[model samples]
Target: MRILGVDPGSRITGYGVIELADTKPRYVASGCIRTRNDALEQRLAQIYAGLSELIGQHRPEVVAVERVFMSKNADSALKLGQARGAAIVCVANHGLAMEEYAPRQIKQAVTGQGGADKIQVQHMVTAVLGLNATPQEDAADALAAALTYAYSRSGLVAAGSVSSKRKSSSWRHFTP
Candidate 1:
């Protein structure tokens, strides 16, 4: 199955695409949709349009999005929520099944620790996907979200074997 994972932000929304073949996740593409410092409505429209175009191009079987986490700054959180909502609406409009995963859940799935930092997540994602170089921060986060969905669907997360399974250089070698 092809999965599209999203890490939404008001200024820049990241997206990654991966395909699961025989329970192994293969990287397809990843990038960010950066919006100009414009009106809030304009930014939201840009996000929706960008995601819609990406969905059409990729035609993923499912979409996984990171849920908005509470922030100390209410305004920041509200903006993130709006961005996330735009992403969700884009996925829904594409008629694809959508799954929401928390930030901690995504980190745990990728790095075997809920509190893993961005660098750790990036390293793990690169190792699991066998990328030549590390992806950008937001792109790596998006890829982590995709990896989370892949692991969850394969029951590795539920079995509590992500740490062991991720030791492999590639998901192709992941037994679970």
Candidate 2:
């Protein structure tokens, strides 16, 4: 199954694509969606548009987004929330299934610890996907999100909800 993971931000939104097959993950793509320094709404619009284009291009089976991590700055937090909402709206409009995972959950899945730092996450992401180099901070975070979902999904496959090819029997409500 192809999975698109999103790491949303006000100035830059990162995206990663991975194809999971036979308990192994193949890296497809990863990059940051940089938004112009403009008004908040315009930046949010850019995020939505860029993510919409990515979904159209990649056509992922599922989109996993990192949940909001409350920042010390309220304004920053609000902007991030807006950015996340914009991205979420774009994916929902594409008629795709979406899942939300906490940032710590993502880090834990990728690095075996919820307190892993950016460098650690990058290293694990590289190792897990067999990349030649560590991905950028945001991109690694996105890939981590995708990897988290794929690992979280293993229980369903064990439970016979998925076939050998990762073909599914259900969409939502199956949590691991």
Candidate 3:
């Protein structure tokens, strides 16, 4: 099964694709979709278009996305939410199965630590996927998300087993 993970941002959305062969996760592709400093509507459109093209190229069977977390800055959080919404919409339009994970859950699944920093996550992602070099922060996060789903689906890590504080949502199909 192929999974596409997305870390949505207003300025730079990151995406990573990974395929599960048996119980192992293999890296397929990872990159960022950068948008110009333009109006919010324009940036959203760019995100939609970029992800649409990516889905077409990768043909992932499912998509995993990071859930937006509340930030100290309300404006920034709002923009982040908008970007996440755009990504979710894109995946829905493609009629793919989608899963959402929290940042902490993703970290735990990848690094065995819920509070792992970006550098730690990146290092673990590189090591786990046997990549030549560490991926960018956002891209690594995206990969971690994909790996999290892969692990859960493979029973390497049970769903919602990372913490008792949070519950994992089941994958849902979206029709456009």
TM-score, candidate 2, is 0.87
lDDT of 2 by residue, 21-126 (tens): 9778899999999999999999999999999889989999998899899889999999999999998778767777787888887877778778899999999999
User: Candidate 2 at 41: error in angstroms?
Assistant: 0.6
TM-score of each: 0.89, 0.87, 0.91
Residue 105 in candidate 2, Cα distance off native in Å: 0.5
Alpha carbon lDDT of each predicted model: 0.86, 0.85, 0.89
Compared with the true structure, the alpha-carbon lDDT of candidate 2 equals: 0.85
Best candidate (score: lDDT)? 3
List the candidate 2 regions with Cα displacement exceeding 4 Å.
Answer: 156-176
Evaluation by TM-score, superior candidate among 1 and 2: 1
Checking candidate 2 for backbone clashes, the offending pairs are: none
Write one digit per residue (lDDT tens) for candidate 3, span 19-73: 9999999999999999999999999999999999999999999888999998999
Ranking by lDDT: 3, 1, 2
> Clash number for every model?
0, 0, 0
Mark the regions of model 3 whose C-alpha exceeds 4 Å error after superposition: 162-176
Per-residue lDDT tens digits for candidate 1, residues 1-176, read: 99899999999999999999978999999999999999988999999999999999999988889989999999999999999988977776676777778898899888888999999999999999999999888889998888888898888687644332221223223246
